[model samples]
Target: MTPQDAQAFLDENFAPWVRALDLTFTDLGQGTATATMPITDQTTRMGDILSGQALAAMADTIMVFACFAHYGEVKPVATTNLDTVFLRPGVGTHIRCEAEVVRAGKALLFTKATMFAEPSGKAVATATATFYLA
Candidate 1:
């Protein structure tokens, strides 16, 4: 999907809290989705490190679109499980996530996302998610 189309989808379908994340999709291709989130004070915790909650939410959000890319349409999907690994303290102006479908079947899909601190391109976190497609 084009960036505009991705943005429109995000605006229309996500819950208000998810929309509050302000994710901007830079690329949405078959089996993949990428987004960038600017690190604001609201998303940071003690020591000014970006909160893991925000990262997990973004990872889950991108997996929904990743399923769309895999299925060729937006299917009714729900996250059955999400696992995130905080590799390092996220310190940057922005963090970007790239998600891809690792495995896709008729009823279930597994996806993975890697988040990085921009400019320096240092790895921040990684996530894996499982979704049930109805």
Candidate 2:
């Protein structure tokens, strides 16, 4: 799917609070997806750093698109497991996550994502998720 398509999918399927994060799809390719989330009061926590919840949400959201791209269409999927590791403080104008589908099984999809603080491009967090194809 194209970036526009990804954005549309997000807007249409995600919850209102998640949509409020103001994420924008930057790129989409076969088995991959990229998105950016602006760091604002709504997305930040103590010390103005992006909250781990928001980062993890972005990782999960982008990985969903990765699965769609890998399958060449939007399919029903649910996150069965999600693990995120914060490597650095996310302090920047925004954060970007690049996600890829590592494997697509008959009933499960494995994905990984790396989040970087924009402008500096410093690694902030990484995530791995397992999605059950419904």
Kindly list the per-residue Cα lDDT of model 2 for residues 61-101, writing each as its tens digit. 99999999999899999999999999999998999999999
> In order, how many clashes per candidate?
0, 0
Query: Which candidate has the highest lDDT of all?
Result: 2
TM-score of each: 0.96, 0.98
What would the per-residue lDDT of candidate 1 be over residues 1-134, giving only the tens digit for each residue?
67677789889988998898889999888889999998988899999999999999999998788888777667898999999999999898999999999998888999999999986799899999999987
Choose the strongest candidate by TM-score. 2
Clashes of 2: 0
Estimate candidate 2's alpha-carbon lDDT, on a 0 to 1 scale.
Answer: 0.95
lDDT value for model 1: 0.90
How far residue 70's Cα lies from its native spot in candidate 1, in Å, is 1.3
RMSD of 2: 0.6
Q: Residue 2 deviation, candidate 1, in Å?
A: 2.3
